[model samples]
Every structure is written in structure tokens, then in C-alpha cells.
Target: MLPSITPFGGMNLRPRSSGSGGVEEARNALGQRLRELRRRAQLSGKQLAESLSWQPSKVSKIENGKQTPTDDDIEAWTRATDTEHETEALLASLHTLEVQHAEWQRVLKAGMLGHQLELSEQDAKTRLYRSFEPAVVPGLLQTAEFARALFSRAIMVHRVPNDVNDAVAKRMQRQEMLYRTDKAFHFVITEAALRYRLCAVDTMLGQLDRLVSLTSLRNMRLGVIGYETQYVVDPRHGFMIYNSDLVRVETYSAELNLRQSHEIGLYTSTFEKLAAVASYDAAARAVINRAIADLASAQPEDGE
Candidate 1:
């Protein structure tokens, strides 16, 4: 007999699991909308789950967006809550998300990860990229040499050997979105980043030069908070804010995304506090240039 297998080849085939930020965002948006409707209907999770013959845990999963609801679940929910028309409309709007998290083979076969990512990210009207590093420049502003060194370190030491060239190229390509008339990119970087030298002396100098050059763009802004300055916003984690609609926090094992109003408010406030303490314009540039010079000077004689 043929081995038992799922129609999708036993793969989860969930759209949010595709490792694409765009797909993830769409999934999250659907979840947020579902929770809002549930709240508006005044249906406690238990009540909703019981009415649909589902476990409370399952209801929680659907609302939290940990799991996607099938068509039957959606119909059951809408009918039970007396919001069939509104729910139907919401489902139509989110149909794209239903297929967003496709399998990796599908993406690879299409050979368009970069383009697809660009399309997804571009859908956002605005973006704010925040970075904190014990060492090394942020990828968005990194020079080729600096990027190579950093990738080597991450791959060799951290064992996260992403395709360095492909990843770097994707990052640089993403920067173009800042210049587009439709949207702009905002950057927040830690001063400690300026002090770190990930590559050779010359490469570090080149990277700093690039950073200085990019600072003049009208669509982009960079801020640096001196390490000696007391920080009012003490974030225990490092996160990136996307389009003011999503917060992505990073950890060694996985990433956490926050879209709930309460969490979003917390990060917004945290970012503002960090920005308040940061130095911008000439002051920030001066700090970066000085660090570059200091790193260059610390190198030994050519023959040594």
C-alpha cells in the first residue's frame, strides 16, 4: 500500500510559516481583525468555542493567530456572532494571506525571493529600522567589505551561514524603498555600532565613509546615542519596527512579533525615549568619523 501522506505532502503548508515577513504580517493582520470582531460581538472565547463545537484552546489559537481557521470555522464564527456580512468581507480582504505562506520549494522554484520580498515590504507605506549591536554596522548601511567580514563572523561563529552575497544584496535592494516617493525609511542605530570594527582597517574606513555619505539623503535619517550617555529607554531586547504597524523582536532561537495595541504602544514609547537620548545630524556624524579614525590609527605598521 502507498504510504499515508497529506495531500500537501505532509507539509504544514501554512502561509505564515514561509519565512517571509510579508506573509507573516498578513497573517497577523487577519488575527488582529478576528480578535477585534470577537470582542465587538461580546463573545468570550469559551462561548464562541463551545457554540462552534471547538475547544477553548482552539478559539484562543484562532484569535491569537497561532492557527488559521478553515472556511467552516469562519462561517461558524460569523453566524454565531451575527456578523456574517462583515466577516465575509474581512475574509475576502484577507484571501491573499490564505496563500501567503507557501512551501520553500514553491518559492525556490519560482526563483524570486528577492522580488517577492520587495513587493511585500513595499506594500507598507512607511518603515522604521532600529538596530542595536555590541559590534558591527547595520546591514542596511554596510559597505561590501564590512558586510563580508560580518557575515563571516556570523556564519563561522554563530553557525547562521546565510548566503552572504545574496543576503547582502537583498538588504541593499531593500534600501531603495527609502528613496521611493511613496515611502521613506527611518533608521535608529546605537553608538556602540560605530565603535565596532568587523572587517580590516581599510574596510571599516570604507564602511564609515559610506555611512557618512548616506546620512545626507532626505529620505533617510540616522541617530546615534553615545554609550556614556544614560539611556532612558532600557530595552531588554533588540527589535525592528516595520511601517509603524509591526514590531519584530529577535532572539537566538526565534523572533517575536507584536501587533497588539498594548505591546505596540510600549515599543512606540520605548523608541521615542531612545530617540530622545540619541544624537543626530552633525553630532552623530562627528562621533562616527572619530571612531573610524581611531580604528584606523590603532592598526600596526604596514610591514609589522
Candidate 2:
């Protein structure tokens, strides 16, 4: 839980736009269904675990959505509860949860280019895109060179199959939406994000320059929160809200796709809070300029 803090009410907190809810709710729904089945069979959690020769915690975790059940585990559970008929339904929910939280290795199994293309498809149809970053620039605003450095870092960190060139190309292609006048874009980044040099000093300098240039676009709203900006909400991780409906949050293991209205609202609230304190227009450009100058000053030993 986060420490309580007052919120800034200056920025709008309404949902941005539309998107599919992914797994978090599905996991909870599945857990409730399993608990219902257990109750219907007149079995206590301990009794069910004992009958299946599994630890009681396993039953509790599965019932409360703390853990995901295996196929065999589910089979044993249904058989023990005489609810085998529920197997198909349970499996379907599990399947949805698994796909929604697909591990990075599986997502990049076909290499990074595939995911880039998938993102491109989504961006092409999105009417409004809102993104918040605690560190690093959003992909939609990245320069090709900066993206190459970022993807290369991903290859090293995740040890995924490297198709860096193709992936970078596809990512660049996805940036075409910046020119589309029909869609609205709102981006909020923290001072830490501007300071984090994900790329070499030269590339970062260029990236900072790009940010400054992007702010000039009529359809784009870029906000930058300074290092000392007051925090109403902690920016735990970077997230993007697509069309005000779907929120996508990436962590070390999986990308969380949030579709529930309250979940999306929570993110929307955070985005607005961050935006309220963020510098915009000339102020935003000054932030980028300051970053560029700092990067340039450090370029002697950092350009790679």
C-alpha cells in the first residue's frame, strides 16, 4: 500500500478512451468460481487439500487468486470435489489468464519484430494514446537510433533472440502515428526519465532533441515533472492508457493488460495527477533542452 497523499485536481481524471481487459480480473473471477465449486461440494479448503494430497496453502492460494493452478492440479481438484463438469470452464478461464500475462520469452519467441508489428496494428486504430514514464521515453516517441540502443539493451537483459535491426525498423514504422491529426496523444515523463540515459550520450542528446521537436505537434501534449515535483501518487511503473479504456503496464516478467473500468480509472487518475505537476509548452521544451545540455557535457566518455 502507498502512503496517503493529497491529489492535484487541476488535470482531468476522466478515462482516456477504449481497450480489452486482460488477466487480473480473470484471475479473481476464476478464483471465485473455484471457491464456489469447493463450497458446493461441502469441502473445507483443508479437506480438499488433504483429499488431493496437496498442502492446504495451495487450496487457499488458488481460491484467493494468489497462485495459478496447473492443469493436473485443476483435474485433481475437480475430481476431488466431484465437480469435473466445471473442468472445461475452469480451464477456459485459466487459458485467458495465461494468454493475458504471457511471459516475455513466449512473446519474443518469434523475435521482437512480431510484437512491434502487433503494436503497430493497435496504434493504427487507437484514437487517443496517453502514456506515463518514470524512466526512459515511450516507444511512440523514440528515435530509430535511440530505439536500437533500447532494443539492444533488451536483448542483453532478456537474452532474447536478436533481430534488433528489423525490430528497430518496425518500431520506427510504428511512430508514423505522430503525424496523424485525427488521434490525440498525451505523454507525461518524470525528471528521472529525462535523466536516464538508456542510450549513449549522443543518441540520448538526439532523443532529447526529438522530445523538444515532438512537443511542437498540435496533436501532442508533452508533460515533464521535475525532480522536485510533489507526488500525489507514486509512479510504480510506466503504463500506457489506450483510448482511455485499456491500461498496459509492463513489469520484469509480464505486460499487465488492465481492462476493468476501476483499474483503468486508477491509472487515468495517476496520469492526470502526474500531468498536473508536469511542465508543458515552453517549460517542457526547457526540460528537454536542459537534458540535452547535460548529455552533451557528458558525451566525452559516454558515446558508444
> Residue 187: error of model 2 in Å?
0.6
Predicted structure with the largest lDDT when compared to the true one: 2
Report clashes for each candidate as comma-separated counts.
Answer: 1, 5
Q: Model 2 off-target regions past 4 Å?
A: 1-25, 35-61, 70-82, 301-304
In the range 42-143, model 2's lDDT, one tens digit per residue, is 999999989988899999998887887878887888899898998998888787787667566667777778878877877877899998877778888888
lDDT of 1 by residue, 145-249 (tens): 676565544445334424667755655666566577655555666766666544577887888888788778887777777777788756344445666666654
TM-score versus the correct structure, for each prediction: 0.58, 0.79
lDDT of each: 0.60, 0.76
